[model samples]
Target: MTNVVTCFLRHRTAVLLGRRSDAVGTYTGRWAGISGYVEGDPADAERDARREVREETGRTDATLVRAGDPVDIEDDGREWTVHPFLFEVDSREVTPNEEIAVHEWVSPPAIRERETVPGLWAVYAAVAPTVETVASDDTHGAAWISVRALEVLRDRAAVADDEAAVASVARALRDARPSMAAVANRVNRVMSGGDRTPGTVRDRAAAAAEAALDADDAAAATAAERCGVSVVTLSQSGTVRAALDRARPAVLIGESRPAREGTDVAASLADAELDVTLTTEAALPAELAARAPDSVLVGADAVLADGSVVNKVGTRGLALAAAREDVPVYVVAAAAKVRPDEAVHGETGDTAALYDGAAPVSVANPIFDRTPADLVTGVVTERGVLDTEGIRAVAAEHRERAEWDGGLEGAGTVSG
Candidate 1:
């Protein structure tokens, strides 16, 4: 059995296909989605799909929409298992490598008219739902997703209120993205509302979720009020953006590597017509030394009971640097981001995101890191700026309530 990966790089409504060159092995001169053999780990096949697309097409901005289950096909007595992937790209510009003579972006329906590799269209059909899921996720951040999840529960409540059904939805939302503390806290809030009447429960949960967003805005505004002329931040955060919008200070952003979310942040601020300086992550300290911004502001993925802020991978470094420079580091987030329990720093994705397999290499791509409470000047929440004591009190209250609501029996523990 031979394992291979086939990637469908999509731009808007069209899918890109390359006409295989005569110099390439088998299926020469035939049209196919970017294809390659699975290397190293089978689990890394999706990563391989992305790498192949980059190598073959020179497009680095494609977002992986979905990776469907592999489909097996018999061709010339050899069994080929094709791993299919769908990526949404912004541009349609194609720069072909030696393996591909030329490329074309064709509509889905028109794909059948062209002479192509077998089962090419079938692969797309299998993964259509996956693309739809990516497209449908309106909330790009954990905070937004948490609110949306609560909204879903409220809608489900209007129908029939079953404990199993509610739990099922809660579990799916919680498990959908485990590392987001806001997701856990928000879901726990709704689940804690108990299996009361679906309407009451739904109303309470929906209200709570909406309140969280409002608090987020308030917290960001409060944090922004304390900032100086310029601020340096890493990663792309809705809370940070909100604060920046309010503060309207000169901003320096690190083009966060791997994901490059900071680039998004920079573009957004630039569009707002704010004075923004975009730089590489490595150059942050030099920028800090030269500019000396009033404060380093960031958003939290989870605000732990000890008051430590868990955020994007580079956040800890930014906080530490701010400490040395005597610049206060503030985390702006809604109270919903606070978790009663210890933070969970989830594992990141494949190493292929960092390197091509041309040479033997090992890569560590952790998505989040925790900044010690001591380094944090303050945690700006909807309730107000929380010192360590204030944070502990808030966390204790939440835990006590969660214990009662989550059916933890006598388990009501909060560590300061």
Candidate 2:
């Protein structure tokens, strides 16, 4: 049996694909990812994958995101096994070696159209997100999940006939993460729009994905205006990191418990040259009182019509601490995060995450919590600082988007 490794280098929404040269390859002129034979112990498959990426692309700065189980396939009567790995490369620049005759970065789904090596799409599928993977992801933020939701909608839109299957996908995405209102809102905007044909749904989903990404950047920019000289925050929001990058504030971060996501965020911010202080969730109140930062800038998973914010479990406590210290708390998120009502169903994590020991005591680990509106000083969005009234107004607009609900009222309008 032949053993090989396939590496997929992704930059943002696109993945790198190389066209094979005519010199020495069996699949000459065929589109493929960076791949090579796997040698040594099977556990060293990732090591070999990275080596191939470095050798083929002439770059050594790729970071591994995920790896898939080895896949078995038969190509032209040759039995083989493929180990797949996905990496995130910061830059699109690739100095292709002789193995690749030409290289181009493109959206992942576009790879299916070209004539390629056997099982290339299947290999790619092993490492990419499916509707199930997107629904189950717990480490990413709401904005990130929302964009992925749009991706799920777009990728699955054209896979069926009645397009009712696509509508079901949209609903599944909407309910995937109950705490992530941004995902539901973005999907609602795309599905509620006129025309529900597969083509229209796919195009609309693509457009919504772009707009959601842009809205995140714009919201970050708006939040940067109020970031102040000193700020305290918790959890890990890509938008919050972007805002911090723009302002360069002296930051204090609390390690969001269970997952301790803020510890990772602190390292990233510090790497970006920002002065950062890391603290524990239990000691955050003391740190806030002693340091007295100018603002508590946090990110939101959802903003309710009454102006309350839903975020990571520690966020409410952070806001409460900030309130007591006379520090203003600013919630930064896109306006689309605001929902018409406070329909909440927060997910709980594995009890093993909190207590995996042989203790008689029980453990509860809720993944999120809602912070009261009164505790938040203001909500900053892509549009600007929104007052309570402004938030409610946006909610009212979202309320009108219920035209597509229940039994697929607009399911018939799907794209062809």
Candidate 3:
């Protein structure tokens, strides 16, 4: 029924609270922080907080440390939407108006000993965890970030189910690792789910991110079904490995040099009971000609608008060789790998990794390379088999305006 801004002015280890005076309209004789009814838009909550602090405590130099996610509290029949904030004050001196009888700086542990207003403790309890998780450095991969992001959103939804807050959280997560299309896809789907309450947004985001793994598995199965009896692959890709595991086809893995990612792939395939043969980059042509695999399957870090794929190094060369051999080349990847633009390839790898025995001889070892669209027979994805046209359609459908503008800014990592 009313919007209020509640601010906690904090020192090193304690916070300031006011004992309500009989002159105040509500919560008389109860302990609370500096709070007042929001007079205008919720966006003005910060300004309102500053004004409340100056008016109640006569402190004009409090620095805002954190603006927490808002919490909704039910008082009698009216609903009080409380926008919580934490401010650091240099001085603890207080000059209370008629709204307060006394001001006390209380330590966190001792706050409960004093009789506080309803849902006062719940305010910090609701917002702190979500804020902490969002600002934490523990989040790394797509799956880890997805789970952590959803946790923050769920907590945020419990307090304020506002679009602005949800969108803010989504953008932060999406920008966490721009190279990860799964993050963007999950967040975009949730944001585009129409104007719903915060709870709905949080729920949809959680479900989308949680189901991403299963969706990837389903896509891998489809890719494997499309492959032939003997498949030649370069580099290591989780999607490709999944597909190969499901298909159980005899594999010819090129020893992706500089990094030798293919060794890992070969080992995984061998462990899965699939016949595996590992060949060096220099000997790939001879190996391909000798083995004569029916198909070349690889995984894409990004599938561009032109339907070309960007993957680990040596993919372009392998595809060219496969094309010359008249073998079908398939990219086993999830739909999230599709991008609106060509990926920004990073600098070459550490040349020292190529040959420790060389000094004057220069080495060029890039991490990834582009394989032309013409070389690719089709892209196998969770959405089923997709040709160049199909990939283009996917880009048109899911690629947001922001992606088209710059293509996931600061995506420098070479991941597949």
Candidate 4:
């Protein structure tokens, strides 16, 4: 069987699609991913995939998200096996080679509407996050996981017209990150709040992803307005990053441990023209006493019913430090982050991530901690600073939407 690699280059919410030129050997004038024949070791398909992206799109920096298993297809008197790769790029700019006549970045689900080679959607299915991937992901925040959840719905919608897949994917996504209000809240919104057959859910999922991104950006803008000139923060939250980029305040940050995400956060703000100080997660009291900031700003994994914030493990200490220093604490998060749940789910990190040494010390690496609402001065969202009552009102609305059953029950796996 002949081997080839199809690389899907993705930006923020959309993916790159190109129309093949007449000069191309096969499927000329049809839309396809950046692709080329795998001329070397099949195991080097990833190397070949990146090379192909560089050749076709002139993007040498495309980061691979996942590589899918080979898909066999019989087409045009040839036996073909296609290798799939998905990549994320920071910029949307591309300079296509002779292979493509025109290129456009479109939602992955929109591929369903395009005329293309056989198994195009199937190729995407391999590289994209499955229900299992979304369920087991422990490295990202709620907002990021929520987008991947919508992407799961998007891919399922692209593959079939089965409403069962929609409900199944939605239910799976809600449970994937139980502590994440955004994942469940947003998925439930699409499943119940929208016209959600498989065909329709694709567009709705795409639109909802866009809305979530916008809400985060708007929420960041609101928080930026409230940020004091001196701020103490932790963790690498996209919403926090956006707000800090806007505020450019003096920052005293702690390493959000088990992962030194705070270092990355500081590096990300290198161009923001802000003064920064980085300390260990355990040095909260010393750091706060040494450099008392005006506010302790953080991003939430989930905002509980009473406005309590669930965030990185170091956040409770940070908030307590801020309180002792008589500084106010502000939480920046999208409105969807407010969940109906009153109790925070404890998620422990991998023991290997904490300690793999021969010592018999048991490691309990709780990934997050809750900061009481009484200690929080304000909860900033896209709607501006919400009072305790405002936060509770939003949580109640989500509680109403929490029930996964809109009307369809017994939405098991898709069966023929």
Q: Give per-candidate clash totals.
A: 0, 8, 0, 0
Which of 2 and 3 is the better model by TM-score? 2
TM-score for each predicted model, relative to the true structure: 0.64, 0.91, 0.56, 0.89
Better candidate number, 1 or 3, judged by lDDT: 1
Candidate 3 global CA lDDT score: 0.71
Q: Looking at candidate 3, what is the lDDT of residue 203? A: 62
Better of 1 and 4 by lDDT: 4
Error of 3 at 389 (Å): 2.2
Question: lDDT per residue, candidate 2, 140-186, as tens digits?
Answer: 78898788788778777745465688788888888777677788888
Error of 4 at 24 (Å): 1.8
lDDT of 4: 0.83
Candidate 4: Cα lDDT at 232: 86
TM-score of 3: 0.56
Query: Residue-wise lDDT of candidate 3 within 152-207, one digit each (tens)?
Result: 55445545647677667767765653444555655666666665477686566556
Q: lDDT for every model?
A: 0.75, 0.85, 0.71, 0.83
Clashing pairs in 3: none
* Tens-digit lDDT string for candidate 1 (281-350): 7888778878889999988878888889887778888887888899999998888787776645564645
Q: What is the lDDT of residue 8 in candidate 2?
A: 94
Judging by lDDT against the true structure, name the best candidate: 2
